[model samples]
Target: MSNYIVEMLNIRKEFPGIVANNNVNLQLKKGEIHALLGENGAGKSTLMNVLFGLYQPEKGEIRVKGEVVKISDPNIANRLGIGMVHQHFMLVDTFTVAQNIILGSEPKKKGVFVDLKQAEKEIVELSERYGLRVDPKAKIRDISVGMQQRAEILKTLYRGAEVIILDEPTAVLTPQEIKELIGIMKSLINEGISIILITHKLKEIMEVCDRCTVIRKGEGIGTVNVSETNVDELASLMVGRDIVFTTEKTPAKPKDTILSIKNLEVKDSRQAVMVKGLNLNIQAGEIVGVAGIDGNGQSELIEAITGLRKVESGEILLHNKSITHLSTRKVTEAGVAHIPQDRHKFGLVLEYPIGENMVLQTYYQKPFSNFKVLSFKNIYQYASRLIEDYDVRTPSTRTKARALSGGNQQKAIIAREVDRSPDLLIAAQPTRGLDVGAIENIHKRLIKERDKGRAILLVSFELDEIINVSDRIAVMFDGQIVAEVKPEETNEQELGLLMAGSSKEKAGEL
Candidate 1:
């Protein structure tokens, strides 16, 4: 009998114009957390998709517990005890947790109607057993992202998944939630379940993975025991070069105020005040970072400034001109560019081609359009240039935005927003799902823009990014700026305390 629980040998998957996976090999041992590491568009997800039966390999053999099997679809994979949790969660917003989990497989009372009560009961027990504390009755939209992810895990567990594939599980989680997830992974392994973790973040692999396999440009590099390899080695193998963890930048040269927010008050869709009496100013040639836990009014502030949300009572000035109530296009026309936090929702139209998405904001202006008629030739030529400049790996500029990897999608958005060279750039969670190399490039671009005498407002959950990229750090808590400190003078510990509503003196004393 084979020692491996699952083995994919010589897997190759091809798209129209590119080979997504080329003779990649992976072996998952019993009850071990095996990590799949690669850069964006490097075929990590494609290989896992093939395992989950979402796609068929052009050439390969898959062995499950020493038995060769053909997994033709997700149902077949599930029957083989393999389940996958995708990066972008698949759940109906209106459905309750229990309903969503037991959608296709439900307990029928008397073989007529679904016995929801019985399903919830089973789900509760399963959640408890796996330490995934989710409310079975809560609507998916009403729950936090972390809770939703836990429910996704519970779905796999309830379906009797002996092997679970988590693709970038921690990408959307908070630090505390990430720690909890790590604990959950350990518990799952203790119960004799195996895991395949696909991620770009090196820290998580070092913390939890037993072993890691590196893939570069759709080709298998090698696999190594996590204990024997450091982050530097893995990163070099994945990207074919030594990755720089830190961003290098010179001192900022402040100029006149570019954007100023005074007594800004904004309300959310539910009519709740999210940004309360917020006051901030950004000068040309500097980047000011807002550091806060998620849901502390960062989104509201960005929306209000970019004209995506209505400002209840406040003044937003761009070059001393009021832009508080302008339309989104007007705001953009006023030399303000926004790289939104939710890329799919606000940044790009998934159905549109990459070239079209690049010119979304400037489609009406020439040379992209002449007399309101779009020039496809000019649009694609412009997109090709940006693609080359930003190093965005895509099949072609004609590819759909949804078809690209998450990191590559983000790069496209950044390319479009930054290439405009606006006076004030608002970057919200700009490097959220990017790899180390991509993050380095993004930081350099932000700094390069700042050096061009543009004011930048950077809002992010990453303390390392906030400290490394920002000229000044603004600690936000409870919908307001609690304190402002120079990046060089503060550390993550102090920032954490401030983000938790601790006073500077209290943090210092502690």
Candidate 2:
């Protein structure tokens, strides 16, 4: 009998005009956390999809406990104790945590109606056992993203999953939440539950995983124990080259102010004020990064500046002209470009072709359109250039935006926004799910724009990015700019203290 709990050997999967996975192999042992590392669009997710029965391999065999079996659907995979948590969560906003957990396979009352009370009791027990700390009665929409992720795990546990697949689990979590999740993974493994963690974050793999398997462009490179390898070796193996972690740039020469926000106040969808009397200024040829914990009114402030939300009381000036109440189109016309935090919601139209999405902002203008007549040739030609320049891996420009991987979709959005040469470019979580190589490229581009005398406002949750890329760091707390410091003078520890509302003197003293 094989010692492995799950094994996928020589798997091959293909889509139209692309080979997503070819001859990929993976083996997971019981009571271990195995990491699958790869670059964006490198077929890591495709291989896992095959294992979860979301897609069948054209050629390969799967073995569970040395028994060969064919998994025809997700239900069949679930029956075999396999459960997958996707990158984008699949929970309904209106459903409660307990309801979502026991959705398909629910406890019944007299074998008829759902026994939701019993389901909640079982879910509570399961969450406690794994140290997940989830509230079963909370609505999905009302909980934090970390809590929602815990609900997803509870759902898998409710289905009796012995093997869990976590796809980009830490991509959307905060630093504190990430630490908590690592603890939960350790506890799960202690109970003999195997895990396959798919991620590109090298630091996370080094910290949490026992072993790692590398894949490049749809082929398995090799697998190595975590203790035997360093981050440099793993990065080189994943991208076929040595990766540079820091971006190099010269000192900034600040010029006149390009954007000025005075006494800004904004509210969220729930009619609660998020941005409270905030004030900021950005000068040309300078990159000012906003560093804060999540839910510190970063999203609301960005929306107000980009004209996606109403500014209840404040003034937003671009080039010394007021634009507080202007429409989003007018704001864009006034030389302001935005790379939104939620790419799917604001950056791209998923149903459109990549070529069309590329020209969404400029399609009505000349070269792309003439007298309301569309020009497909020019649009596609433009998209092809950006695709090549940004290294977006797609079969063709005509491919649907949804067909591309999450990182590719993000690259497409960045390409469009940066190519515009706007006076003020606002980038929110620009490198959220990108690999190290892609991050290096983006940081270089931002610096290039700053050197070109453009004012850039960068909002990110990553303290490393803020310190490395920004000339000036603005620490936000409770919807206001509490402190400003030069990047070279500050470190992550001090920033973390300030982000948690610590006084500047206290931060410096500590």
Off by over 4 Å in 1: none
lDDT of 2: 0.94
RMSD to native, candidate 1: 0.8
The 0-to-1 C-alpha lDDT of every candidate, in the order given, reads 0.94, 0.94
Native-to-model Cα distance after best TM-score fit, residue 194 in candidate 2, in Å? 0.9
Model 1: lDDT of residue 363: 94
Worst 10 residues of 1 by lDDT: 170-179
Backbone clash pairs for candidate 1 read none
lDDT of 1 by residue, 411-498 (tens): 9999999999999999999988888888988999999999999999999888899999999999999999999999999999999999
Tens digit of per-residue lDDT, candidate 2, span 118-174: 998998889889999888899999999999999998888889999999999988898
Listed per model in order, the count of residue pairs whose N, CA or C atoms clash below 3 Å is 0, 0
User: What TM-score, over all chains together, does every model reach?
Assistant: 0.99, 0.99
